[model samples]
Target: MNTSLSLLADLLKTAQKEGADRADILFIQTQSVSYQIRNGKMEETESSEQNEIGLRVFLGKKSAIISTTELKPDEFPRLASQALAMAKVLPEDKFSDLLEASSPQRLSKNLELFDPTLPTNDNILAYITEMEEQALAQKGITNSNGSSAAYGKSHIILLTSNGFKGEYQHSSFSAGISVVAGQGPTMQRDYATHTTTFYRDLDTAKSLGLQAAQRALARLNPKKPRTANLPIVFDPRIAGSLLGHFASAIKGNAIARGTSFLKQALGRTIFPKEVTIMDDPTCKKGLRSRPFDAEGVKAAPLTLVEEGTLQHWLLDIRSANQLNLPTNGRASRSPSSPPTPTHTNLYFKNGSHSRTDLMADIKEGIYITEMMGSAINGLTGDYSRGASGFMIRNGQLAEPVAEFTIAGNLNDMFANIGLANDLEFRYGVNSPTLRVHSMTVAGA
Candidate 1:
């Protein structure tokens, strides 16, 4: 047994002896290092290590949760007794209970989630310096915001009185660069970043730096368009936000509270027939992949949307009980919080058309590369946000544009979505280039 599992097992026994019907515990440890460089000099370096434990006790229909950073063996009895006392006073929550015990299946296939080789501080510093040097070497690049590299590892152990015991460890590495282009008042800034579970899978520092420089140079001088309704194409970098909104609307808690725009759309067609969205937790080396969810349920792929129709709501035990549905293993939790529904490795299926083909038919359109602000109403599906990107004219990308707002209801936008074949899994929530037939663009 893992050290954390042994500790949690002992704690659960103490809770039961203290008048708790059931209990579950989580233990986590994380270590990280980050280094940053700016203007040919090291700007900052940081290192952190943390260990936390959380305990949840249930007495029939009531439950209470508590977390602590103190892990002394003598403190376990006090912590368990405290949780039991809190549960006794809390109002009954009929939806709370431990998951039923079953033979827990360990991951048979290698997920490639961890890399044991830890990068030294010198290695990280070298990466940041190379990235900064490459970005500064670009002709139009004038200044740099900074370049950075980070590496981290996390270990988790979950135990329940119902007989579930599991442990996993994963590591992550990332590199990024941000640069300014042009001079003085006309300067524009852009950045590029990449992260991976395996250090070897990270993109080259030079590639990331050059990409940032080119993007910044492209936005040296931007124009504002006349206010009008136009075809809006979302670059792959920003297209994932659309999917994020969709996921939020389909969360089980949102559905139970009638707070989601998608509350009444279950089993109905909510998008074009060609659109399909999926949440997969089993992809090899996926950034968010795990053998099981936070609640001890086996993690599996789920089709949230299939052929334009809503399929299933993301759910955890509590939210599922609220809706009279089964848990779908979408539960995610931190040491200090209870499990909640969250998507892992979510993405839209790639479309058959290339990006050029998707935009070729539009005589005039906006290609959004970035977005800011949050003016979305989840209950009504109304979407509005500040945006910046380039203009598409005569089937080609034109000069950059900024200082604009794009507005539309998500329902209307989903119905008109046109997808392109440029999907990449660089982000956990990923999407291909997408085009919406028409939307209101407010600009000068």
Candidate 2:
């Protein structure tokens, strides 16, 4: 065992000896470097490193969590005693308990989660400079907002009083550019960025800069259309927001607390028969992949929605116990926080129709590429948001539109959703182009 793992194991043992029935320890060390450039000059540079340890102690049905940056052997006894003292006075929570004793699954050697190669700080700065230059070279791109490149890696270790013990490491690389187009009152801004587990998989700086410039230029002189009810198509970039909303609504805590719009939606046809959604934590090189949950439960794929019916709620041990359901291995946590349910690499299944085909039948509508602000009622699913994109007229993209509000109930929106075949796994939450039959577009 490595030094950190050995230390964490000893910490758990100390907690148990200090009047605790069960205990768990989590350790995380992270290192990151980032560079930012604007107007062909380096504006900011940053490097960070941190290590933290969290201890959780259980005394019968009462448990308490504590964390610190101190990781010395002599500190273990004090940490254990402090945590147990807190647990002793806390009110008993029947649902809060460790998983039954079981061996944690070994992490796969071929997870492809870490990249050993590290780019020099000079290389990162060069990339940022090139990104900014490319954006400024484009026609009508007047000013650069900024360009940035970053790399980060994290090492994680977990140990419990039971048989569970595991560790893993993951790395990330990302580059992005944001620029303004036009000048004065008509200026518009847009950005493009890509992040990947391996440095080689990131999009080239030139490609990202050019994409940013084109998006900004396309939005120059945008107009607000007349108010009306019309079909609304969502570009892949913004369509994922719908899936995010769905994920939030189906979290186990939301369901158990009666706060979710889909609280009573399980096993019901809430969408079209063709719609399906999945949360997969085992995808190789996935941005959010994990070998096990924070509670040491083995990770597995889950079908959240199947053939229009709600199939499962993402859950951790506590929420699952409250609902009298088994956990789906979706628990996530930080060193200082307790476990909570969250999805990993969530995506909707692709549909047979092309994006063009989905918008071809619309006489007049909007295609949303960006959305800002939200006014969603989680309990009632009433959704309203500010939107910007292009007007769709005669089966083709027309002039750009902005400063509009779209309003509808999420339940109604889910029922009317139409998926397109352009799905891509570019983000943790992925989706294809989506079309809603009709909505109130509050434009001037």
Candidate 3:
């Protein structure tokens, strides 16, 4: 066994000897470096390295967790003893238990999650500098907020007394730029970013900077349209928020508590038949891809929504047990907290229409490129948010618009959703450009 795995196994043994009925250990190591440039100068450079261990002990129905950065062999006994004592005084939770043992499935293919070509400080600084320079050179771009480049890698090792042991490592690289256009009261700001598991897959710094500058320039001199019920389109950049809200409304915990708006919508058609949402944890080189969840359960792709019908809830072991269902392997955890249900790489399937095709028939509509604030009621699915973008007129984008509020109930919005074919996996939770038939626009 590896040193970290051996250490965790020893910790689990110590916990068992300390009177715990069950136990698990998690070890993590991370390293990261980042560089930022502003106004043609390198403004900051930062780096971090961390190694930590977390221990969880269960005494029948009671459990407690403890964590430490110190990996010294002598510390295991004290950590285990402390956890056992804590568990003794805690209230029993019927749902808290380790997963049953099963034969582990080996990955069918390489995930390509790690990139060994670590960029030096100078390389990161150069990328940021070039991005900032490119953004500042754009016409009408008055200043730069900043350009940044970062790289990070994380290693996770999980061990449990129930014969589950797994370890994995992943890497990430990203670059971004934010710039301001126009000047004074008419000034507008926008940003662009690109991230990838492989260093070579990241977009060029120059391209990112140019995109940011162009976006900011396009937003100069904004106007607010008259209040009315109008079609509202979401840019791919912010369209994922709609999917996020839907994901939250179907979480197992919320459903179990009867607090989710989608709690009673299971097996019902909640959207157009063309709409399908998915969560996959095994995609090669995916940002959040993993072979197994934090609980050592094998991870697989889940069709959360199939043909517009709610199919599954995001669940962890505890929530699944409470709901009397099997886990979907969505459990996530941190050193200081127990496992919780979370998404890996959630996204919607592409639709038949292109962005232009979706907008072609809308004589008047708001194409939302940016959103601010959140006014959502999870229980009712009532949604409202400040929005800014360009107005779509006669099948073309025309005139910048801002300072407007879009309001609708999610149930209606989902049913009315019109998706475009421009889906890209730039973000972990991604969607193509989407349009809603009608929404109340609160504006001038």
Candidate 4:
């Protein structure tokens, strides 16, 4: 048995002796190294490792959680007893408890999450420096905001008093560069970044640097459009934000508290007939892939929206109990907090039309590539955000625009969505280029 598993089992026995009805524990160990370069020089380098353990104990209807980096075997008794004592005085929460159903009989197949090739500081520094140099080599590229390369690995172990033991490991490699174009007040900036489970899968430094430079050069001397209700095209880079809002609104806790605009919208048609969305925790080599969730529950694939209808809410054990629904195994947790509902690898499906075809009919619109601050009303679905991008004039991209606000109710926006066929899984929440019809654009 793993040393951590033995320690956790001992802690559970200690908790039982302290009058706890149930308990669960988590162990996480991580190692990471990163390098940052700017102006053709090494600006910073860091390497770190962490070992942490969290314990949660239940006393009837109450529970308490605590964490510590002290992994000594003698410390288990005090940590377990302290958690039980804390649980004794807490207010009763009828809905807070472990899953009554048995653990999944079988775990999912190996997801190939780990990459054995570790990164050396020397290699990372070289990689980042080269990335920055390439960006600064561009004609109009004035300066570099920064360039970075990083690699990390983490291992997790979970155990429960009622017989659940599981563990997994994952690795990550990432690189990015941001550059400025032009000079003085008219200068603009852009960045290109990519992350992957395997080091070989990362985008080349030359490609990323050039891409960032070109994007920044495209944004010089942006003009603000006159305020009007016009079609809005969301670039694939930023379109996933819409899916994020949907995830937040359908969190089981939000629905249970009646704080979500979509609280009462379940099973209804929330999007156009062609729209479909999915959440897959078991996707191979996915950024967020995991065989089981924080609470030792196996997470199967979930179709959140199918053919326009809202299919399910993201749910954990407590919220599912409150709403009288079966837990869908979406629980996520940290060392010192209780579990919460969250999605893993969420994305909308692609549509039949090309991006050009999707925007061909729009004479004037905004093709937003980036967004700023947010002002979303959960109960009302009112949405507004600062934005910057290019103008769509005569069915083609025109000069860049900035200092504008896009405003619309999410309910209306969802219904008006028109998707393009260019979808890629570059992010945990991915989407194709999409257009929303007739939204208010607040600008000069």
- Candidate 1: worst-modelled 10 consecutive residues by lDDT: 103-112
lDDT, candidate 4, 1-444, per-residue tens = 377778778887787777779988888889998888889777888889998888889988999998988677788778888898788889999998887647444877689889989877777777887788888888999999999998999998888877888888989999999999999999999999999988888888888988998899999999998899999999999999999999999999999999999999999999999999999999888899998999888869999999999999999999999999988999999877899999999999999999999999999999999999999999999999999999999889999999999999999999999999999988889999999998999999
Which tens-of-lDDT digit does each residue in 1-444 have in candidate 3?
Answer: 387777778888988998889899888899999888889877887899998888999999999999999777898789999998999999999997899977766753477788988987777888888888888998899998889989999998888888888888999999998999999988999999999999999999889989999999999999997799999999999999999999888888889899988889989999999999999998889999998898988879999988998889999999999999999889999977899888999999999999999999999999999999999999999999999999999878999999999999999999999999999999889999999999999999
Reference-based lDDT, residue 267, model 2: 94
Judged by lDDT against the true structure, how good is candidate 4? Answer: 0.91
TM-score of each: 0.98, 0.98, 0.98, 0.98
Clash pairs, model 2 backbone: none
lDDT, residue 401, model 3: 99
Residue 414: error of model 3 in Å? 1.0
- Tens digit of per-residue lDDT, candidate 1, span 286-384: 999987888888878999989999999999998999999999999999988888899999999999899999999888889999999989999899999
The local distance difference test score of each candidate is 0.90, 0.90, 0.91, 0.91
Off by over 4 Å in 3: none
Which residue window of length 10 is worst by lDDT in model 2?
102-111
Q: How accurate locally is residue 341 in candidate 4, as Cα lDDT from 0 to 100?
A: 96
lDDT of 2 by residue, 292-351 (tens): 889888878898889989999999999999999988888899988889998999999998
